[model samples]
Target chain A: MNEVLTLKNVTKSFHQKTAVDDISFTIGKGEVVAILGPNGAGKTTTISMILGLFKPSAGEVRIFNHLPQEKQVREKIGTMLQEVSVMPGLKVQEILELIRSYYPHPLPMSELISLTGLTGEELKTRAEKLSGGQKRRLSFALALAGNPELIIFDEPTVGMDISSRSRFWQTVDSFAAQGKTIIFSTHYLQEADDVADRILLFKDGTIVADGTPAQIKSQIAKPSVSFIVDPETSLEKLYLHTEIDDIYRKNNRVYVQSSNTDRVLELIFQEKLAVRDIQIERGKLEEVYEELTRGTKEAV
Target chain B: MKIFQMQCKMEIVRVLRNRYFVFWSLVMPILFYYIFTNVVNTNPQDEAAWQAHYLMSMTVFSVMGSSMMTLGIRMVQERLQGWSTFMRITPLSDSVYFAAQMVGQSVIHLFSITIIFIAGALINNIALTAIEWVMSGLWILLGSLPFLAIGTLIGLMKKVETAAGVSNVLYMVLAVSGGLWMPLEIMPKVMQNVAQWLPSYHYGNGVWEIVRGGAPEWKNILLLVTYLVLFMVLSKYIRRKQEVA
Candidate 1:
């Protein structure tokens, strides 16, 4: 795999607080990696360092074998930051033209309009006058204007509506299919689970886990058997087994969390507990994300 | 070169679309020129020389407002709104971006100066030799450097609200103290002393001398240069501090 980005022990500190601790990772070409974390988990800080907005306090970041701040690297990289703001007075079309002019080889206007789903009327309107959704679409279009080899998005879907959000992912899907290296940080766990080839789970300025979605979920998230039990039945006998990792109740259903659901099932039957509607719940990405990010010790 | 042109073109478009620029730079100066010279009729001496002098004053007034208010406020707003951050990641270098901004605002300043000079000619029929007209306009253009530097300093402010407030107060105080609205001769003795130390005064004095059949004094030129250097260095230092923070 061709390496598109590499961070070696890169760290960023602001005043008294260290935002990104010493961390290293390399992303290859055509990989769609999701950086997932709660707010202030150094996600934005890391993205800023990658985009050359902030210099690392220690270590190095290289893109395409060059410093990120170099012009050669900037030409190949495109980004949409968390805040969406365009130049105030120019029409959308004019602003697009200005930004496109900065690149050596820009995407043709027709393709940019088609990909971003910007209407003719919206393009004619002044940028500051556009609705919130229109602004995001325009920002997305600007990110793609350079026809960059590497694209970075920080919270790309924060203010997007349902339809726009789906459209955004669809465009990203097509880009990924075209062998573009994409990196994004998102609060939507489902988006990460569905879209990312690999997840870099971050907590407290460090990567707590990094792997394929299936590998991460299987490694940390435990499967569980959930059942509707009678109110009077005691679940104390089920807890005596060391195989059970946890037990909890929600919506009047008792969930027995363990890696081996069959053993839990047999234990339940042997106890002759009056339980019905029994179902097994596979470990999900959301649970893995929660366990890792919430700093829980339940993961084996 | 092409990128610089595009950036400058878009910046000009942005400033032209601004309502405040239209109001403060164009309309207000013309109105003040008409009211002060014609309505109030305070010359009490050679009306033509007074008209020409006040014309220089209003022209400087307009240029100063655009520099401090339009350029300064827009800079702060752009930085605060994340537009500047977005530009940083692009292939556009920071020097090119800053140059484009300064060039764009200068073009608007030229437009403002031309409009007020034309208004002075029509309203009061104030006429000068071709050399006087050309020289005065050239001096005003060159002498506005200090005010532009001041505008850049205001742009360094973190908050748009604070920048706007500061620009307004600075613009008004400088204009009044420098005798752009009225002559320093009739003002209090202390104000006359205060005007000598201000860039606005030197900026107007250069043009005033040009329209009065004399070249700009070396002292006026030298003082304006000093102010320009001082403000630019101050702005650069503040910018370095901001980047560190």
Candidate 2:
């Protein structure tokens, strides 16, 4: 596979404070990579460097083997930043048309509108008057106007409602299906887990972990089984099993963390314990993200 | 070229749709023209001259207001909201973006000059040949370039509210001191000396020279051009500072 983006020891600093530490990664074409981190983890700073909005303090970033600031390279990239910054007092169609005119070849207005799910009335409405969700949709449309090969979204669904968030991801999925290289930075761990083929967990301006969701999950080496039981049914015999790593009770549910879930199930069945609402889940990416990034907070 | 044209069109449409911008750039200036020439100055002997002078003054006033407040405030707001940064990342070049803004301000300037000229003819019976009218209009439009640069510089340096306040104060001071509202001869000697150093004075004097059927003096042209270059450089420096920040 062709590498679409390459970052080599890229570092960005403001005065004496570093925003993006010396970190490097490569993204192949047609791959969706998510940069997941909490606020101030340098997610936005990294994205800005990729978009050529900021000059890195050290190292390099290359898109299509060219510097990100090159016009030829920028022409093939689209971005939707965290802030919705579309021109005010203009109708949606006008803004779309204006942005489309910037590219050598652009997606047709109809295709862009339909792909972003902009309703006809929304197209006619002034950008400033649109609701928050509608404004986000418009931002998405602008990002896709150039029919970019690489689309970078910085917290694209930050303030969107649940329905709008789902719809936004649906639109993104369709674009990804067309073989577009996608890179987005988001704090929404579930979004990264569900959509990204590879996730880069960032903390303290550095990548704490980088792998597929399953690979990251496997690092913990434990699956969790949880079920609600009668508050009075817990017996001391459950603690005798060495297969379980840890056990905890929250409200009416008992949770078992174990590499061997089958043995735990056997113990529960043999014990004749009344259980309801049973749920078994492998180690989740969220837990792995928390485990990896939690300790590095004070080191920097 | 197409991108430039599209940006211009979008800006024009935005200005037209904004009632507040339209009122300040168009309606208010025309009203001032009527009040100053028709109501304040009714001398029969110098009625035509007063009409022509005030027409040029109000035209300059409107141009300064539109270019500084309309274009400058918009640029500042865009910078604050991250729209300018967004545009910078796109394929659009900085020169093209600035060119588009210049063209938008020029369109507004042209409209203001034409309306004031028409008001001069009908309300004050100010007579001018086609050449004189066209030449004077071009001079006023050209003279407003420094203010456009000033506006862009202020936009880059300050927040939207601060930009608005500074531009308003600058506009009024320039108008009153430059003799756009009242002649410098009526003012004190020290004020007239101060006005000589003001770029607006040179710009207004250049326009008045054109209206009186004389070519603009080279010194006045040099002054306006110097101020334009200074503001342009200042804006560029501020932009670099912002990028670093």
Candidate 3:
């Protein structure tokens, strides 16, 4: 696959502070990459640089072998920024039609409405009158209107409800199935884990970890077992087991963290511990992300 | 070209739908024209010339109000709402976007000119040849460029309320101080000196000359052009600074 986006040691600084430190990455055609980080971690800054909103203080960014700001290159890119930006006093169809006119080829208005889940009455409503989730849906529709080859979303699901978020992901999934390049920045770890083929974990002003979701989870390999137990049970006795790394109680449940789940289970059975609704789970991306970012912060 | 047309149509639709803008730009000018010509200056020795002058003044006022207030306030709102940033990332050219805005303002401006002219002819009995009418209208349209640039400059302000306040103050100052609301001869001598330096004064003088069936003063036209160029350059600089920040 061709390289749809390439960043070579790109850096962006605003006065005394650097928003994006030296960063380099490449996204191939049809790849779904998520930039995951907490607030002020430079995820938006990096996306801005890629979208040609700001020039990198150093190094270079190229999209489709051309500068991102070039008209030809921008024509092939669509974006739904963190900010809701629809024009006020214009009907939804009017705004969509205006945006659609900017591209050489665009999706039909009917198709766009259906894809974004905009209802019939919404077509005549003013852009400013839409609710938060509806506005997000409209923004998504605009992003897809251009029939772009690469779509960049910055916190695309920030204000959406559960059903809207699921619908949004389903739309994204369908778009990705068409082999289009997709890049999004988000703080939702599960969002990244669920949809992204690759994740770039950002900390401070740089990427701390970059890999598939499973690979990132494996970096913190300790598995955990937890279950509800009687509040009176003396779970403190399990702390003496050498194989169990840690034990804690919360509410009416006990949690055991161990490197080997088999040994922990054997010990639990031998001790005749009363447990119900037990669940054994591997390290989650959220835990791995916390450890990586927190660990780096302490190291500094 | 098609994109430009579509953008212009959208902008025009938005401005036309705004009740505040339409009332100020379209309705208020005609009201002011009627009150000033009929009530304030009822029995002038040269009724025809006096009526024509006020007509031209009100037309200039209307164009300035529409171009500056409508365009400036809308641009400020767009920036605050992130629409400007969205446009920056699109494939649309900046020139096309600005041209569309200017075209929309000019449409409202032309409407103001027509309504004020109709009020002047019907109620005040001001008469002019077809050629004089066309020339005066053309001069008024040309004189509006500086205000358009000024509106863009004001639009660069961070807050919509601040921009609106500043634009209102500037509008009143230009109208009164520039002698668009009254003749400089009737005002104090010091006021006339200050009026001579105002671009609005030069714009009013050029349009007034055309309304009186005379050629536009080259010096005043030149001054208006200079202010237009200066404001355009300053507006561009401010916009670039904003984008970088």
In order, the Cα lDDT scores of the candidates are 0.91, 0.86, 0.87
Q: State which candidate, 1 or 3, has the greater TM-score.
A: 1
**Tens-digit lDDT track of model 3 for A81-174:** 9998889989999999999999999989889998998998998999999998888988999889899999999999998889999999999999
From the highest DockQ down, the ranking of the candidates is: 1, 3, 2
TM-score of chain A of each: 0.93, 0.83, 0.83
Best by DockQ: 1
Residue B36's C-alpha lDDT in candidate 1?
87
lDDT minimum window of 10 residues, candidate 1 chain A: A291-300
lDDT of 1 by residue, B150-234 (tens): 9999999879889999999999999999999988999999999999999898889988898889988898999999999999999
lDDT of 1 at A234: 90
Candidate 3 Cα outliers beyond 4 Å, as residue runs: A225-258, A263-281, A295-300, B240-245
Q: For model 2, what is the error of residue A14's alpha carbon versus the real structure, in angstroms, after optimal superposition?
A: 2.1
lDDT of 2 by residue, B1-245 (tens): 77888899887888878787778777887888888776775464676776777788778877877877788889888888888888987899988998887897788678777877786688778888788889888888988888888888778745778888888898889889988777787899999999999988898888788777788899899999999999999888888886666
Error of 3 at B162 (Å): 1.0
- Error at B72, model 3, angstroms: 1.6
Per-candidate TM equals 0.96, 0.90, 0.90
